[model samples]
Target chain A: MISRTFRRRVWLVLCALALGLAPFPVSAQQSVYIPITGAKKLRLALPDFKIGSADPAANSLAQTFDGVLWNDLYQSGLVEMVSKSFYPLQQPGTPTDLGGGALAAWSAAPTTAQRLVFGNVVVGNGALQVEGYLYDLTQPNKPFVLGKRYTDQPTPAAARVIAHEFADAIIAALGGGPGIAESKIVFISDRTGHKEVWMMDYDGANQQQLTHLDAICYSPRLSPDGSKVAFMELSSAGSRIRVLDLLTHRYARFPRLGGTNATPAWSPDGSKLAFSSSRTGDMEIYTINANGTGLRRLTYSPGVDIAPVWNPKTGAQIAFESDRTGLPQIYVMDADGTNQQRLTMSGYAVSPSWSPNGEALAFSWRRTGGGEGNGGAYDIYIWYLANRNYLQLTHNGERNDFPSWAPDGRHLVFAVGENESWQLFTILADGTSPAKLTTAGSNTMPNWSWH
Target chain B: MSHSRLRYLCTVMGAFAVMIALAGCRHKPAPAPPTPPPAPAPAPTITLNADPTSIQAGQSSTLTWSSQNATKVELNGASVDLNGSQSVSPTESTDYEAVAYGANGQTASASAHVTVTQPPPPPAPAPAPQPSIQDLWNQNIKDAYFDFDKSNIRPDAQEALQADAEFLKQHPDVDFIIEGHCDERGSAEYNMGLGDRRANAVKDYLVQLGVDGSRIRTISYGKEKPFCTEHTEACWQKNRVGHLVLATPAQ
Candidate 1:
């Protein structure tokens, strides 16, 4: 017979597991759970079309197709494309199997290929159609197919969209999710006269300006409700917290005391707002009714307090950045302004965002150098509130800031340096390779929408 | 003139009459040399000064005037009785004038501007010390931490609860509410429960410290409220804790 203690331990484990597996509302789900067990690795083959055929336009079309395909595959992060220079064809009929696979009917012609890629490009009536197939050297019987027909009658720009669609299709065929080629990323871009919020597809397409105010607006946070955006707007006098209704296109300022206010965070219920204010002569956390009444001061320290976030599990407490210890560190305090506690002991940390489960907080900690772009680099880190363990999520020497965790807590969206341009990037929670999600102007202050 | 003793006594009498007349004319001329007109006396000069020039409202000030042979003094357009000097206290600024009456009842006067400025009262000292939980909360307690989805006391939470325990032990009548809160990431319902757990945790810890558990009530605001609404983790961490509030006195 099992001991009573053993039975109790087993029961506790089961209960924890059940809590972890609780089902969320169907409408609240934004991500599809893809099982990795059925995922398979496949190869592709593309037919070689002459660089400049007798039909000059057809050859040009083939060259453009090759370039597009190469770039798409390189960015897909799913397959490794073998270099063409490794295999040389001495003659047209030379059997060139680079990976030692049996060459089929085309073995006579310089058919040196590992995983073969065969395609045909036809130009007809001002339209270009490219069809291709990818074959695995290990399994010659099955080949992955890919094709796209582009109509250039309207304009050459239309062809780019077609090419992107083909790339997405290839990604899906390879058992990867659809490439973010069509998805858009909304971020604050200062390319305009002022720092206005803008949106562009992940591939830098369809750039559109969202805010047109003369005042400086920064730290745009998308509402979990998906209907509004809350951001800090700065004027000559002080900062104003405002929310822009996406559907109505109307903006409302948060009623605040007499001082500069920044970092407006909406509670999970959307009934209250948490922000930092200097009304009492120093930066401190404050909460007010969402309609902007019933203001209550939450922190009363001589040190600078800022960057407040609410816990998802309990809205009664707030996490903020404070310099009470002579260094910027993370601190947790009661919602009513009592029971203040310091959470992080070292490093200059800011931008603390709670995960959906409230078990972890993701913040940017300055590395030894300094903050990125300021002669120092920073990385996104998650602090497990329960265990007091910190996990660094980025290794790049660039400045990464404003990390927002996805609803599932498996992925995080942050800003990373790309070619001297800061853009939005997403990475796994464990600090894996980052995928660029925005290609427009420098994008910062990314807040992921909640499911 | 006895007809100058009528003529005669003609010659001799006439001579006597002339002598008499001459004597009378001499005496008369001297007497009647019309009492010459008396010289005009000079005007008396009056100067005024007030002791305690600046006096508080409803206080009196002494108005002193110096006059050379002046008999009367007036203050603020009103007559003031004075022997040598006069005491006049006006609610507002005023001018004082003094006049002296000569023996013939003729008056010579001099005037001075006597301004009575009101003085300000002294500042009151600060109130004496009172028992306050604000001071205790601010000075003694550092901060409180909560477990994931829990408001209850974890080992880490004891450090802050201990401070509360000490504060209560020192003041037996003190009562407080443990307000629980959650971060902005979860649903409102989940956050409410989490906040409840946090408040209960602190209350339990206070109870363990020999404090009256009944004196401590728990209120879970849930994710409906937050201290910092920013998307940053710093804000979320701040939103997750148990707040201590002084209980309102019974009506």
Candidate 2:
């Protein structure tokens, strides 16, 4: 009912409001880990890798590489990829292909990916060649954030490794730091008719046996530099804490404390080892030099005190499991044994692995008031050091335990179980995606390599 | 009646009665010439002797003992069965004495000195060939089983340990190691500690039974190895045990 002039005025006012509410200038930001205030995922694209060879083997490997790459990026919980349906009409297969308006077209319309990662693969002569390129389209002009290549035998195992390595590189480039792709997970496996130490890639590929002791070896803990592993080995004489030097491929003698010596944890500096020893007439926390000389007793409780993990950040404190209160719970104290404090009040909690940043602890927690027979009764929980509160990463009735924090602090490796067999699984700190890392040999006691 | 005649009659009667009393007192002709104290009981021959009354150092011999006409006997201040034999091992030449008591409160003794001669010097024990801990484990010691996640000695485990203690007592020169184990049901680090407790519990019990504390050491395997691979309770029970290993320098 208004006149033409008044209608035009209302329309102009509406237009001004819309223009004023526009988003921030995305072109100025160069980082992919943006908006650090909330639980937001980065918008990215992972197009199929381009094949460079005419070999039919190359064609099949490309498909596999692409599938693994997509899954790896998705499971990272940091990148939210645009659906393949919404990809740009023209897909660039390399960093050089970002020119000629392909980048402009990919950033427009239904394709609103702010970052792009593309690569090429070649398979011939029993070898596979893979190259990956990452770019931040927010800059619009800069094309190369990183370019990495991998060469290995043309097999499914090598293909998985290549995919995981590329994913790690891309994630490292985007997260403003490093990722866990190049890391290894050490665990106990019974595949050889005896419990032995075994290792696999971060993505659970190329599982190779490490220890041939043909005896029971569990609680595989890697040194801070990943040069050695300390584990519990069973012998007729008793359980002896043994160290295997990965660099020299030799077994090293652990100090014989006479009384039950088990659960060895290396200090942050790699010079001292903290473990639970009953040499003092009871289960007490003890520290010994790595070469096995100085024996210093820490905890004096009549009950058990074990599973000591050093805080990688300050190296001043250690998180451990203790039953001084009748139920095993997580406790923190100075590395020199002072200021002892309980981190968990109730429920049975053990196997505490401190976060790399010293900001949180991850462990298996269960409400110990009974009624836990059904499943999902035990779960992985992270206790934030600042607020003293916790977040449950797994729920329901499935038992999840032995959570070892990745060096990145954003992921954790834990043991997931059903009935008797247990397997290793990795998930983000936010509990978004869970990827299984092992399947053979009833594996458990997974320890992630330190960065 | 004259006084002299009455006195003569009284004297005659008194003389006859006195003679009768004298006859009663002297009935058996001077007690058969004083009977020589029944031949003095023959002085109780003890004959405390050892069969093969000599031994090489570190060897054993049987001590055979007997006594005659004795109510009680003792050897080296310890009561031994009369006329019995016992095996005795002496580290050095030692003298054994047997004292027997007669019925007359008198004692007699005999001594059998077993000569323990030194043999040729043996090889160095540390470097000498001996069974390894693993080998001794299979043949020498018994294993103590535990309840799930528990280190305290259970009833079944105690029965096995009693025999172990007895074996230890019998073999003083041999030491042992107690290995605590678990059944892959708990955290590895925690189980390591728990296994340690189990082994130590056995060691502690052995120590209580007069076994030298230093003779028994303990270690925890923490569910690292399983003797049985099945997932049944029986398999788990096999895993939760304190295995014994004889301690030798070679081991």
Candidate 3:
């Protein structure tokens, strides 16, 4: 039989050991959070201007002013204007003279009225000056006034310029980015007989011609810095790679490799080049230092290996097309001659261009068994590097080839054959509705400039 | 009467002695208990003299051992095939060991390593000079000229072809593959077809000259296999010709 005192001593010892072995609670460190402050939303009101000149010959001026103002505001996508004809043309009583403040007088017009804009136009000596004031209905004392003075301009045209200037100031005062309504897109158009690189505003205005070479030139690749263009030109001898200095109007040839040379691809670093050469008894992929020395061959198969493109993010690997399997297929190999592997298993594929993000490869593939004329009708496809899944971006039976991805990688520009003439078209990466960007001649092989 | 009284006294004395004997008993000493045996002595420990030692290249060595009362014996190291002594090949050598164990759980071990060097490979064969008909013809035709508007063999050409034919006849199984070529002045397609005719003409002449026609075959590589790089008539004349490839039956 055990004693009670002995049992109590054992229990006390057990409690002490349990308490000594217990784990301590941990405390987390404190962190600071910063909140982002957004700019205040300001509503701008436009002033109403009456047609001071009603001369029959001056009607064009009135129409031009109204047109410019309406188009500018509509394109802004920011301002909402109250209908002028919906309200009666009567002046309300002065706020100080009445028992109400400016806010009460502004709100007295209508419950839906948020702001008010008043303006007047005066024409003199074939010139015009317009002044406008924007008043906030909620805060009567806070009103923004803007004025524009135009000289050496006709009464009709001056009003148009004043309206545009007013819209520009309002956009800037509201702390918004500049409107791109006046920007342009520089592209190549063959509308004037031969394919000549052209530049126009993004809205299709101010078109200008750049290249005048009479020979056949294609595959215009823009430099990453956007100051030069590297393209392929066919002369009496054969195809030669040339670079055009956009600023100097001078051109230099990428050193020739004995046989026909085409498809000049600039490395991501812009310090080297990867191109195809047949000088080694067959068409194989070759890379040369940008200064043209150290020409090393990267592929050694008895097949037509062409269209070498480098991964934009990593200069250590290159993707190209090889016919070693008796048909054109996509292949990838190290920047050096190691670890050569095929990436695609079907169809005659060509013209592989890497996306700027290096996450996908955009190439053109012909439908199987589609021979000869069917060769022209290729579908633009993208291969996801992570999953090896491919998505076709074009559904039209017409030819779609030479896909060049935009700098953002969200859209792609390619040449589409329509009505027997090739035109430039842009489509979303998901193969949604495509928009025709050019309406003229046979324009093919568009390379977007990396800006 | 005196004698009877003495017998009675003796009887009484004897009877008293017998009574005293019946009351007293004699006892023997007990045998000493058996003594227990002493505890057994512990087993003797074993010791070895030779240990596994490394040897340099081209060296040979032996393993030696010593043990105490060992009944079971073995040699364990890099190999058991050494069998007390090992002679390593000159190309490769290795370490060895000797081990012994007794039934009383005592064990001993010994080892030694040996090494050897390797030899080099043999030399390559010499190249042979196998000249073709074109080489022989070019050597003998240093100044020989062909007739105008004709591809017939001249005197020099005949001498060269005869030597080649004689060489072929001596080796019955040997065959020759001939390639005919033309100058670059004529149309490529026409010259290709014409070169074939010139080679056949030569082959037919060889057959009539006692050479087997079955041993010869011809191909035309027209305008492609030019002998001279210049554009002059002299270069063109030399380029318009035939080439021959000779081979043995086993080649």
Candidate 4:
């Protein structure tokens, strides 16, 4: 038996050598192994950025970048930015600024920070330059995880852009998919006498009016590719779901589904659009090719069916709002409208926005009383598909409605009414960290950009 | 000449006797007793009238009345100023009575009938197109309302629809666009569909009331165009309604 086994092993090794192939397989996965650390968010130490000189402009630029970077990372829903007060007495603004024996011990367990982020910002000769870095304190052997350099005009807006870019790099390292740092939120603003499509940075900066159609244009939905926006514009011809390409600044061709067409939603692949149309004398869910052809009806229910949202990941199911059961509630159906199931039981629910993972839904809901007493007290709520349970994301007051999820799937942007005007607001998916986003005029119907 | 002289002599004798009688009367032939006091005034007379005495449905008529010596006056059991007038719009033939009470504890009433005639349907209006929805909504056309998240017609809104239906039938040329609205509560997407339900609910009622179904166009504004800005129940109730827009010929 020994002689036979030895002969077989020799033959196999000889064959491998003859074929110039390796004798073993390597198992390698490139993903970083980030410990969940239970329910606590990853703690990050953000220190003040260093300025090349004591010049007032340079110092101001440095300060602006630091604040913007901190706010950007803090809102990512993955990190809890540690305050500078909790940092070590010997604070390091840059790798070279570290005191003796600090860089090696950069793993500041005393501050409960597992990671650290800091950079240097310099404004000289009418130009701004910045360098950002991220350090994984646990790995002293190779602590640097990211390094980025950005150069732009020495303006406050440029400083904010630099910070946003750096924050996105850090988010990518943390495995939160592509960061929404450069994303724009296309929404409806009534600042110019008539409601029109407007866009703003993910951080609510650079709010620009995209459509000048001084008519009623609203319900803006950014296509998955972030290049086109489809919305309903009211005209003498009735409400039409029209498409506006941001890059081209022109209305793209759209299928003409007569009657009243409104509340459009883009499919995950951007090949088709789902909307509610009353062309048949009753409002029903319909899908049409993105190029204004191949129209087909999806829901034939007697009650109204509208506001269709597709599951981003799977694309096999859609969630929409319907009153087929005598009250408005959230309903899920197969892509073809078969196997429809109701997801809400109690209060009137609408705007069933599917979570990126297809496991949850966020919708605007309000409890109904004697037809006249809903109080305009609607709030955003999340329904978990797995547990068949629901959670309220907003409390009373302000009448929060129209919750649209950021591409990251961890945050939501919604419209809130206060002082008789509706403005944009965002909150974490877990109902934490609620903050206002718009202030000047009534901003509403927010649809977060795909990127 | 002789006859005239004899006549003149007799007349003179008579005048002398009359002068003696006049002096006797001046002596006051026993002052006549004071005439008996006039009898008590007749019961207060209340004349209640309806101007023109007839009107078509949805048309106004003036109810004018005057009374004499009435301590209190009433119309349809509601106390009103005596000899006052008011405008009444009775949808059907109605008899209005005005009653008054006299100081002598006597009551008097006069009844007037405001005759309602169909008026032969106004020659059918040539079956022409009606006004635009903007005009109708501004002209005080009726709107239907729904419960929160509910598209079903509420019981209270049924009467409003019945009246709306009758109006639609009477003015067949007045094509409608039922604009559905919601309170500033639900998501705009779903609320829009809910609005569709409301508008369709009104359309169904109109069709059942004999108006052609195609004559009604429906659109849902969701909660966008709130008629009231307040967040109170009253404002929300007003916002949650189906505005009846008379369709333009082009629409």
* Backbone clashes, each candidate: 77, 8, 13, 2
Residue lDDT tens for model 4, B76-160: 9999998899999998999999999999999999999998987575465477678754665566456777766666678778887
Cα lDDT tens digits for candidate 4, A1-451: 0112223443454466458664443213211111111246678888887777655788888878888788888888778778777777765657776546686544555676888887787777888999878988777767789888899999998998888888889989976667778888989988888889999988888999999887778689999999999998876456789899989899997766666688889999999888888878688888888898988899989978888889887888888887777667788999898999987665677767787767778888774431224544777877667645455678755577789988888788999878667889888776777778899778888999877
The count of residue-pair clashes in candidate 4 stands at: 2
Work out the TM-score per prediction: 0.43, 0.66, 0.42, 0.70
Judging by TM-score against the true structure, name the best candidate.
Answer: 4
Q: Chain B alone: TM-score in each candidate? A: 0.47, 0.45, 0.41, 0.44
lDDT, candidate 3, at A144: 38
Best by lDDT: 4
Off by over 4 Å in 1: A1-179, A204-207, A224-227, A246-249, A252-257, A265-274, A279-305, A308-320, A331-343, A353-362, A367-375, A382-400, A404-443, A446-451, B1-251
- What tens digits encode model 3's per-residue C-alpha lDDT throughout B39-96? 6534433333322244444444444544455565565534333134434433356544
lDDT agreement with native, every candidate: 0.61, 0.77, 0.57, 0.78
Model 2 agreement with the true structure over A329-445: per-residue lDDT tens digits: 889999999999987777678889888878788888875631111123678888767646466788646778889988777788999886778888898776767888877768888
Q: Candidate 4: where is the Cα deviation over 4 Å?
A: A1-38, A53-56, A88-93, A104-112, A235-237, A367-372, A396-398, B1-174, B228-236, B248-251
Superior candidate under DockQ, 1 versus 3: 1
RMSD of each: 20.2, 24.2, 35.8, 23.0
Q: What ranking emerges by lDDT with the best candidate at the front?
A: 4, 2, 1, 3
Q: After superposition, which runs of candidate 2 have C-alpha atoms over 4 Å from their true positions?
A: A1-38, A55-57, A95-101, A108-110, A122-131, A137-165, A370-376, B1-184, B209-251
lDDT of 1 by residue, B27-91 (tens): 55343456778877655556666676666556766767665654555544566654446665677
TM-score of chain A of 3: 0.61
